[model samples]
Target: MEEQRVRPGGPPAWWGHGPPWRDGADGEERRARWPWRSTVLLTAFVLAGSQIAARGQLDERAALDPFARVLLLIAAGQLLWRHRCPRAVAFGTAATVAVYLGAGYPYGPVLLTVAVACFNAIVAGHRRAAWAALGMLWAAHVLVAHRLYRWLPPSGDTAASWGQEAVTAAWVVAIVALAELARARREQWARERAERAQGARRRADEERLRIARELHDVLAHSLSVINVQAGVGLALLDTDPEQARTALTTIKGASKEALGEVRQVLDSLRTPGDAPRAPAPGLDRLPELVEAAADAGLAVRVEGTAPRLPPATDLAAFRIVQEALTNAVRHSGSRHARVRLTREAGALRLRIDDDGPAAGADAGGGGNGLAGMRERAAALGGTIEAGARPDGGFSVIAVLPLAPPHREEEDR
Candidate 1:
């Protein structure tokens, strides 16, 4: 089977793990069903209220007609879609309540569902629709009051008292306010989650870049040595057996060193249940790096004592040196290179110069070696410059702060 390659800059697989409710459309669909379920529960309450009013167990003026009962049930049914189409359902339920009140029916628990519809509108971010529905209810009550006072016989009673209408308005406003408050809280929570996801993606990208730098440093130097020695061995096999044998031995040693470093890189990625990993390469390992570069036919002279460094700075500095040497060996025709290190004012300075023919010696041209070194330096709050010198050769210089960034506290 072909290996699955994760695209560069893609979010890591681990970041994709979380509660299913936060996965977007599917979770919204699941949550949308709750309003309907709530409507089902509210139906029982509406039915009981109607029964009590019909039997005169409660207010006799609030007894609902059979047609008004049908209308109430219809309004309750409209509540089922409140979450999916909050504005539409709010308007439908409020209109049904209005018609029920205007048709000379006694007011009962039917309009109670209208409060829920308004709440759903606010929860669904439709505050305007919720307000509009509340306004329509108030107007309906006004018309009902006017019809009773201006036209009804003085001997007869109104379908609903002004006190009842005022109470319903208060309930509608309260429910909408509570729903809007909840909506605000939900929005805040979503914003926080999005920010966290962005942070995780950034950290993942930085980690992948660090690992890429490590792999490039290890493989580039080791492979360059192996390639050069293999060519030498092939060239001298016919006449100079001892030189060819020495070249073959260098290739074997370089390959072994490359395998060990690459294995360490992979081990760093092992799951928690795996065996403990060996420590990463640091400044102390520069000898091995220098030897590998020398095996590739570059004569290298080291200067200055390596510093006792923080883990991040140590790893970054080592990679920078390794990448610089790899470039010197791989890209240059010269035989000698110079590496100088200095500790000054709480920072480490590295300068690498090679006495090579400066043809096509652009540092970052067509390769990530120089760019990786620059990234390592910048990540440590430092700077790197790689370019051709004024006289003739190429040079790589970097300054790395010993006081690592706050992220270094958390470790790899």
Candidate 2:
């Protein structure tokens, strides 16, 4: 009966966990704040303007009333909570203006304060409230103008009255336009920020997938070697003590190498703030890997000619050789394997052929090891082929391009 490897449970390392952007979306929004200092300064400025307007208009009308000053104070103070309660602030300020006009206090700078409140309402996304305030102020202006025209001799539809009404329209339109423009800019900035965050998260996911492939390759090969050597050791411990010792030693070496590579792969996930670590295992490590396979009692022959390869291609090549040797050692009943490598036409080609039972190969075919190898090669803009070699054994071949998959897009 052919050996059957026990598979690990759970989804692939690359899967699971909701989209990173979804977590970002669930984050709390920044709460609105009312700038106490700025509000105080604005209120002071409004008070000063009202005082000046009242001073000038008082001589032309009735003396200033004490209660009107208190109402003015209340309107100015409401600015402190403008962000927290924009509609309330706007309504409060507008009502203050109405009171001033009704109490016969000259409509001077208090009108400007109410307009500012309306602008704040619009800025807070309270468009309905702002529009209501605008209508109220306009109505107040019309009524006040009519009353003054009827009672005051010099104010009978005078140019001053018409001029004030015109200026009111201009100011109202200006406030609404400026507030709407500010809102648009705020929304645009938010969208840009969200897009940037999503892009960052996307890169993180791709990085995670890459690391998962590396881990799969490392563990799969190393465990396969260890498993085979352990079996050999256990079988021969009594019959051939020396050979058993050698098998145990081989298992140790293979496990140690696997652990080191695994550590290196994990270090890649370390934060940038960590001390720098070594570069990943590359093709230069292939000879050592082949030696490890030989130690595992497999006859591994190598014939390779290659120039300096890119980092990604080099890593893929090492992992491919490692995975092929691991499969050969674990499942191939035969003890002989061949590894051939060549750099041709701007690509690296690797081929591993083993005299292993096609049955063991068939049993391991659906494993993540093979899937990971294919994924790694494709990620580096390459391709892989693994199948039974017609006569009796299994073969794995990989062709890796020098350039990355996104090279053209990056260049552009």
Candidate 3:
């Protein structure tokens, strides 16, 4: 049996890990492998420093005690695995340093090791762990200095040494804080990139929906009319040859028009580097559109003074009337439809009514044509009212503002 391959964009297995690559596989690989190399280098440096410290002691007993040196080397080497287990490394290093300090070992590179451990703890996303490490290290430093090295004054005059201790503490804290900030910045950048990718996917989905809606509106009404005419032509072929020829000619014209409309939509989807074509059906094409519907056996009436409209508004108006006429042909089964376009004050108004069946029952309440018209109107900051008129017919009235709404302008 062949193994089932996981196709791109397919659903994952039931028990699979979350998203497999939310941060991407490449980033996961980097996070998994790079830390070990840094850990190894850190261990080598720590071990070499311990050896040098064991050789150069102010006290003879401290220099002779090799076990102290060995323990210090172990503590330093343990830091090599800090990225893997930051909290464990931090506690272990702090304990080792306390023991070395209590045994009269000099505080040469111990502070540096503590700083590295604190930084690791922060990067591991353990804030409490870092605070605990800092507290433990400071307590151990004060206790060891007071009991063994007398780094603090014997007279308990802290002002003399407090400044030095405070400066050193501040340096360590600053380094850890900087490391934490860097980690936070990296996480923020990753989140921003993920959000942008999500937005792109969402936009692609919306574009696909828009195309599907356009295809449905364009094909549904055009194909319905063509189908009806073809049937009529076939029935009249022998008895009325002239009528049959006219029906056949109408069918051919409708098919050609549908093809051109589809091609135009597809061309709009193409990249800008491609050759330019005729613009989409705007107000300029209104006369041609009216003629086409008239040829389809619908006496389409146009009224009102046309105004200079924006490109988007003009496109919306064209599509609205196109869909309205298409619906009229499909649902009303009527021979006459009226379209009215008027511009008043700061708004444009469009009204399409047909003497078909009442709007509620057959004027496509939930169909694609009605939905497309509503979407087109809404895109132009407009409101559309489509329902049955009291005079036993369907009416569609849309009112669009000359300029987009304030909210829409803010979004732009």
| lDDT value, candidate 1, whole model | 0.74
Q: Which pairs of residues collide in candidate 2?
A: none
**Global Cα lDDT for candidate 3:** 0.68
lDDT of 2 at 341: 85
What are the Cα lDDT values of the candidates? 0.74, 0.71, 0.68
True-structure RMSD, every candidate: 6.6, 10.5, 7.6
* Tens-digit lDDT string for candidate 1 (1-412): 1111111122442233322222244545555556555777888777677666556622334456587678878988887876567789899989998877665455567768888788767656678888898899878777776665345322355455778778877877787778777656555545555666677788788778767878888888788888999999999999999999999999998899789889887776775336536776788987877777777888889999778899889988888888778777777767889889999999999999987675354532336887788888888899998887776778888999989766533311
Q: Model 3: per-residue lDDT, tens digit, 1-412?
A: 1111111133542112222212244434533654556566766776667557656754432442576667667677767666556788888887787777656655566656667777767655666777787778777766655554544322322222667568757876796787677556545545555565677787687677777766876787578668778887999999999999988998898889889878866875886346537666676777766776776667888887568887677778877887788777767756788889888778899999998764336664456677778877787779898987777678899887777665422111
Q: What is the lDDT of residue 90 in candidate 1?
A: 91
Number of clashing residue pairs in every model?
0, 0, 0
How much does candidate 3 score in TM-score? 0.79
Full ranking by lDDT: 1, 2, 3
What is candidate 2's TM-score against the reference? 0.78
Ordered from best to worst TM-score, the candidate numbers read 1, 3, 2
Report the lDDT of model 3 for residue 56. Answer: 74
lDDT of 3 at 135: 75
Candidate 1, superposed: residue stretches over 4 Å from native: 1-23, 27-36, 53-60, 102-109, 146-155, 158-166, 269-276, 359-366, 407-412
Candidate 3 regions exceeding 4 Å error are: 1-27, 47-73, 108-110, 148-160, 267-276, 358-360, 405-412
